[model samples]
Every structure is written in structure tokens, then in C-alpha cells.
Target: MADLVIADVTVNKKASVYFDGKCISHGVTFPDGTKKSVGVILPASLTFNTGAPEIMEIVDGACKVRLKGTEEWVAYAAGSEFKVPGDSSFDIEVSETVHYVCHFG
Candidate 1:
């Protein structure tokens, strides 16, 4: 079994954290004191925490990012930077390996 841990993204540093079945790209703090990061979904992964959203830059393959209230999900290519708000909920569908730099604050 994996241990449970908590983190504060308000400081400054890169943290590659490993959870139960997923690896998360954590450590982000905004000017308004908000924290966020990207959770790397392992094969056969599903999450219930529709985590606080922010902005994501696709650093790799195809990524399907859907907004909380939008009818259509957007496809982001490499180097694509977009905002989806922290309070807004969403999901991800990755056909291939997708990498994102999660910025929250």
C-alpha cells in the first residue's frame, strides 16, 4: 500500500510526487495563494478528484482537455498553452503519452 501525503505548492521548487497508482507533477502556487499541478495518469487510471484546474502547456503528444461547462473538448498539440480555471472541473483523454506543465496560482 502507498502512503498518504500532503504538500504546499506555495513555496518554490519542483516536486515529482508518486501516489497510489499515479505520478503527479506538483508544486505550483499563484499570486492569490492557489496551488495546482498535473496528475500523470497511469495505465488504467481513474480519479474522482476533479482537481482544481489552471493552465496547461502540452509538452508532448495529443491531449484532450475538456472544460467544466464547455460543450466541446479542445485538442491541444505540442507547445499549446491554454487556461481552464482552478475552480472549473474537467477531465483528460490521452491517446498517446501526454505531458503538461501545470500552472496554478
Candidate 2:
């Protein structure tokens, strides 16, 4: 069996939550450590607080990505992979929705 496991998502009052799966929280094992992630997006308008270094690929439709201190963000259509760092906050003006990945240590 794989020694490393993906822990079940938990709900705690002190932590900020985005929808459900996507969030910037602590590592399950390393409680004091920060673990940020972006699970799945919905058709609804979405705003993001930049969490960590991420690698995202467009699964369907389209999305607009931007960071706070950046000049501009790149847009992408389906089957596109975009990398977002876990530094500043950003917004996603999505057409249908965008599913991305994020990580921090």
C-alpha cells in the first residue's frame, strides 16, 4: 500500500473554506504546515485568494486568471495547462469553469 495517503477533507471553524474541496489549510499530518489546493470549479463566478504554486489544465470551457501584483493573467480554453504561484490573490472570470491545482510548503 502507498505509505503516503490523501486524507479525508475536514471541516474546522477556524479555517477558511472555499466551496468544499478547494481550500488553503494545514497539512493533515503536519498540522502546523500549510497545504493549499484548488480542487474543482463550478459554472458560477469565482474569486481566489492565491494559495500556492499550482499547475492547472483546463478541462472544459474557458477561464481568465490574474494575480494581485501581476501585470496581467493569461486566458485559456479547454485542454490548457496554466501554472499559478501561491503568492498573491487572484480572480477567475470563467466561462463555464476551470479546474486547477495548487500546493504550498
Candidate 3:
């Protein structure tokens, strides 16, 4: 499980909105220079490309994800997580409003 509270991190004031506002996120930087994004995806099917390896932590709601080169769609709910390889893409089908924290490396 991810931490409920992250202290002393820098938060970007502006949000990154995508898919015509169906997805929105705010970037955060930790003291150690680690980067992450806290975001929400509304009920929609969307494809996302990743620049860096990422672990998508589900904070609330549920989603089904199909990674690049994979045909299976795996279901994930709150308290679950899925990893995406760098430079890869994934298709996501959101059944509910998904609140997530994306850890990047």
C-alpha cells in the first residue's frame, strides 16, 4: 500500500489534463528528487504512453488495464497496483472514477 500522507513534497500548482479533461493530474517532487503524480481518471477507456517506468497505485475506485504486447486485461481496484514499462503504452478501461498515484522512475 502507498503512504496515506506524503510530507514535505513540492506540488505543481498546474494540473496536466488529458483526454479532453477525462484525466487530470498534479505532479509532485519529493526531497530526494523522486517524482510522482496524483491523478484521477473518470469513467472512460483511454490509452496512455509512458516515458518512464511507472507503478500505478490505485487510491480509489477500479479499472481494467491491458499493457502493451499483452492481450489480457487485468482488473485492479483500490489498494491494487500495476506496473508499466518505460516507453510502453497501456489501454485502460475505467469502470469508476479512478484516483491514483503514479510512481515514476
Candidate 4:
């Protein structure tokens, strides 16, 4: 799949500085008030709780994710995506660098 280009947005460099700074991201906000973060996760295992529904697009590499209420972890590679419901927590295991773009809605 081709790369995504989101036009007319602002970036917040300080966003997504979690997991002892292992996962870093910059927040992107669009003209319509939509928000997302384009970031990369280094090899690590982390869990995140979402305030809103998140659609995580795997832009490069891959990661194994166990969504809220799921017992199995699923692998998502580049050009693939997954969703996590609002107010839910999910676990992600990255064996390699994984590039992702997370859309919050």
C-alpha cells in the first residue's frame, strides 16, 4: 500500500512520551478537529489505556497486539490495522521497530 499523507495538520512533538520514553510520537491535528499521532515503537512490550477509540495503522514493521477482552495476541504487519475501543486497555509486543499512525476518534 502507498504511504498516507495527511494534509493541513499541526504537530505536537511532546506527545506519546511513555514507557520510559521507549515509545515516542508526535501528535497531529487536522483542520476538522481530528487528531492522531504518527510514531514509532522500538522493541518493547507496553500496555496503553485509551480515552477514545483508536485505530492504529501499522505503517511499517509489525507488532503483536492483544485488544481489550481478548486472550490471544494478533500480529499486524505493514499495511494492516487494528482497533481498540474507548476506555479500554490493550497490550502491544514489538519484537522490532514498528512504525504506526494512530487515529483517535
Candidate 5:
């Protein structure tokens, strides 16, 4: 797990809401130019497309994710993480309200 406290980052006040408000996130930028999004996904099934590779760190709650071109749905809970390739997509079913940090690269 990464640090719980993220310091020296600029957080965008405006949120990026998706899936008709089922998912909401705020972009954050580090001092070194790294970018991430801190967000919450309400209980729902959603598909997300990635323009960049992403490592999604689960902060709280649980979800099952199936990556693009895959059939198996992997379960992830608090303290767990999953990676999605760039230019691909993933289907996520959130059983609980999921709090996560999406690291982009």
C-alpha cells in the first residue's frame, strides 16, 4: 500500500462525474508532475476506458474487475490494487461504495 497522506499535490476542486454520477473523481497533480485521481464509485456496474495505463488502488470497500479481453472477474478489496492497460477498458462492479486512487502513467 502507498502512503495514506498525499502531500504537496494540487487538487482540482471540480470533480469529474461519470456513469451519470455513479462515479466521481477529482484530479490531483504532484510536484513532480505525476497525476492521479481520488474518487468514489457508488454501488453500480460501470465500464471505464483508459487512455493511459492505470493502477487502481482500493482505499475502501470492494469491487470485481474484468479487464479488456479477459473473462475472469478478479475481486479486489480495501488495500488491494489492479492494473489496466492503456488504450484498453475494464468492467467494474462495485458491491460497496468504493474509495480509490487511480495512478496514471
Candidate 6:
């Protein structure tokens, strides 16, 4: 996919580190106060719990994900997206660096 350009957004300098630093993201806020993050995941497997419903858009590379309540892991590539319910968790396995934009709602 082409680069994601969200106009009039604020990008914070602080990095959101997770999985003992395996996953990292930065804070981004929209004009209306909605929150989001753009980050890159290293080659690793991680489980993430969401506080809000998240729409994860893959910006680069690929990964396999198994969402909550699901037994199968699906492959996602660049230009694809997945959703995770709030207060739930999911598993992601990445073989390469994967860039993503996460929209919180």
C-alpha cells in the first residue's frame, strides 16, 4: 500500500514499548481527540490485550494473527487490516518487520 497520510494529526515523541521492548509504537492523536498509533513490530511472536477496540492496518510486510476466540491463524499482508475487540487479546506471529497503523475506538 501507499504511505498513510493522516492530516492534522499530532505525533508524540514518546515510544510505547511492549513485550519487553519487542513491540514499539508512538502516540498519535487526531484532531477530534481520538487516539491511534503507528509502529513497527520486529520479527517475533507476541500477544497483545486491547483496552479499546483496535483496527490494525498493515502498512508493510506480513504476519499471521489469531484473534480472540479464534482457533485459526490468518496471514495478513500489506494493505490488509484486522480488528480486535476491546478488553480482549490476540496473538501475532511476525517473520519480518511489519509496519502498522492502529486506530483506537
Clashes counted in candidate 5 amount to: 0
Candidate number achieving the greatest lDDT relative to the actual structure: 3
Poorest lDDT segment (10 consecutive residues) of candidate 4: 1-10
Write model 4 residue lDDT over 1-105, tens digit each, in one string. Answer: 657776789988577688888788999998878888999899999998999999999989878999989899999999999999999999999987898999888
Q: RMSD in angstroms, all models?
A: 8.6, 6.3, 1.0, 1.3, 1.0, 1.2
TM per prediction:
0.58, 0.51, 0.96, 0.92, 0.96, 0.93
lDDT score for candidate 5 against the true structure: 0.95
lDDT of 6 at 91: 97
* Per-residue alpha-carbon lDDT of candidate 3 for residues 3-104, written as tens digits (9 for 90 to 100): 776689999999999999999999999999999999999999999999999999999999999999999999999999999999999999999999999999
Give the runs in model 4 whose Cα sits over 4 Å from its true position.
Answer: none
Clashing pairs in 3: none
- Candidate 4 has a TM-score of 0.92
For residue 3, what is the lDDT in candidate 2? 20
Global CA lDDT of candidate 3, please? 0.96
Task: Return the lDDT, model 3, position 48.
Answer: 100
Q: What lDDT does each candidate get?
A: 0.58, 0.55, 0.96, 0.89, 0.95, 0.91
Off by over 4 Å in 6: 1-3
- Model 6 agreement with the true structure over 1-78: per-residue lDDT tens digits: 466676788999999998888889998898989888999999899899999999999999889999989999999999
Candidate achieving higher lDDT, 1 or 5: 5
